[model samples]
Target: MALNKKPVKGMKDILPEEMQIRDYAISVIKETYGKFGFTSIETPCAESIANLTSKQGGDNEKLLFKVLKRGEKLDVAGAASEEDVVDFGLRYDLTVPLVRYYSAHSAQLPSPFKALQIGNVWRADNPQRGRYRQFMQCDIDILGEASNLAEIELILATTTTLGKLGFKGFEIRINDRRLLKAMAAYSGFPEEAYDSVFITLDKMDKIGPEGVKTELLENGFGESCVERYLELYQGLEKAEDGVAYLADMLKGVAETSVTDNLREIIDSVQATKTAGFEMVFDATLVRGMSYYTGTIFEIAIPEFGGSCGGGGRYDAMVGKFTGKEVPACGFSIGFERIIMLLLENGFQIPDRPKKIACLVEKGVEGQALCDVIAKAQAMRETGSQVLVVRMNKNKKFQKEQLMAEGYAEFEEFYKEGLRN
Candidate 1:
């Protein structure tokens, strides 16, 4: 009989404190990305179910929040399948919608467009720490650029933005889908089994190398293939240059261009990065996107002990929309997770405007109130945050609440005069 006060399962209501941090993070992201020539764009939250389930989003397609047909279109009772009932779904990530956006607007857009998008995405996922069914994603993508320049600029821009936000000593773990496939092929795995193999491989951090080996073998892969595949990882741990080693090891099995491109991206980012971070060649990094045709990467924060954000080359995605190929690469910041870490570590916004609270007693007359308001307005014009409110019966408690909201200086105006 009572209305539910709680949010739906897996979603959250952001409070003022968290909202402050979220706002600041978004500003820094937008400002930093804007300097890199990424023009901001927007796309609708809901997308056609057909496009969302086009098999490009990998496992994320399974987590889509499907939207049912409308009144006239609704035939749920007579529907034979989900397709007959659902027509659209809330987008699970920005990339899919972005590709669709580009497809429709390419004629009006510039060549090699650098686009920046920040928005909420929904997934019917099991909520956990640092994860929610609805969360914000900050993505910057370069379309129509085939060379590794796109990768270099993305890594640089993302890392620089992180640095500006006071993130230090994070790792940008880079890999290539081609390299993943090459390693598997060199180990005698069939092309068809690459996806399943990489699915297990993506858990290397949790399951460890031995765990990955066991899972691979248990999945009916050849024991020799498993050993040979994992040996590459072991070799990487010892090799001075993992990319070079892979380039030579998988030379005949895979294209030399894959390794060369990956190597170029790593070398270029390392040479030009402005952030206090490392550009690592992580052989185990298998970003969970079926559309990623080339280099894949993730942001690894030491404090979080997991990926904070990541993106990769999805050269084939736009082709799906237009039937013509276009080279595209993107990087997305793990916005919610980063905010969680910042909140957990008590990250305060630097250089915040001075906060002053103007508390007027209840009996303060019309002229007195106008004078107090005028004074607060003057303070606001001078770049201060002024909160003018009627003084409560318990002034101390009111001030305490204001203090918690970052209001430090207080001015109490009584009908008679200013109170100390």
Candidate 2:
């Protein structure tokens, strides 16, 4: 009798049929990222326990999934304190681990190195609609630069990448945390405002304009600050589109260098000129991350209830590793979520690259079997997903049965054909 086995909660499987869309999204990311001089790099899935926690600061610490330590004493300890013994863990996000890698390798890299990575990340969060315990991130980062151009470059790369992924009617919302902090200070909420200021601002969209005002007042924000913040969010919604919004926000709510950064980003985006792109300057935007130092951004698609991906300037992540402050900024697309959205919306995926698929007959002629296997492998050499027939087969009815197995596209050569 077979024992029952299934995936643990919060973790999921990637089935074969689903890989078609996943592969399509990844290809778009890599192609668009590469066009921007971004190169691929991968980090180990397991990272030291201390590294992940320290960078995210306090806000995102709750999502980490710990790994138990192993030893002869493991049987005793692992069973009892399952959470405590886990000294290492699957990464929560690609950015933290990448900072460690870049810090370790920056000497061999050029200024403002751009990295494009496609990999899985795990988070231990309550499962809900469009949320998961584990997912993949397609991230792009520019390290060793403090200039705002990195932000602009990130927008171009992300927008083009999403465009290739079959997304339209989406806007990239840019905000400066410094601007948010300033608004809070200006409102006379000062120290107390930090408590729930961003938490309220983050919900400006979902809570409606009046709801945010009520929530902010309840959070102890003065009438002045609440009014300003509300006005900012309201102006953003009316700004025509992303580019138009950026223009309006630059004139309306943005203060300090945040305004300059927004304008420069607009100019860089226009001069660089990627097709089918829009950029919005959203003043009310306050992201979830605690590490963002300068500019911050979120990717919003109407199809998805919330953002598809987001990231911002740390300018200090590398310092956590090397103890030397370094300017770094990056953005990551929630690979699993976007793929889910694409699937849900019934977006047309590209055709499988290689048309040939083989289904072999078991106990068939040895020479013919080897010939079929070799041809399949040869196609894979030029970049095809080749799946070999492994299970036992009844040759008598196999060919007729294989029509539904995706082998109709292949040029069929049977054992009997070779025997002739």
Which candidate has the highest lDDT of all? 1
Candidate 1's residue-wise lDDT over 164-239, tens digit each? 9899999999998888888988898999999999999989889898899889988999888999888888888989
RMSD of each: 1.4, 4.3
Clashes of 1: 0
lDDT of 2 by residue, 1-420 (tens): 987577788777877557877887788888889998999999999788888777474465677777767765446434655445667888888888898889889899888799988888888888876678877778999997788878888888888888777777787878777777765654556665574777877776788789888987886667887786566556656666544454444444445467667678877876785556567677777878778887888988877778888989998778778989988899988777888888787776667455455655445557867887788889889877666664344543764555444444544444574531
Whole-model lDDT, model 2: 0.75
Model 1's TM-score against the true structure = 0.97
Candidate number of the best TM-score: 1
Candidates in order, TM-scores: namely 0.97, 0.82
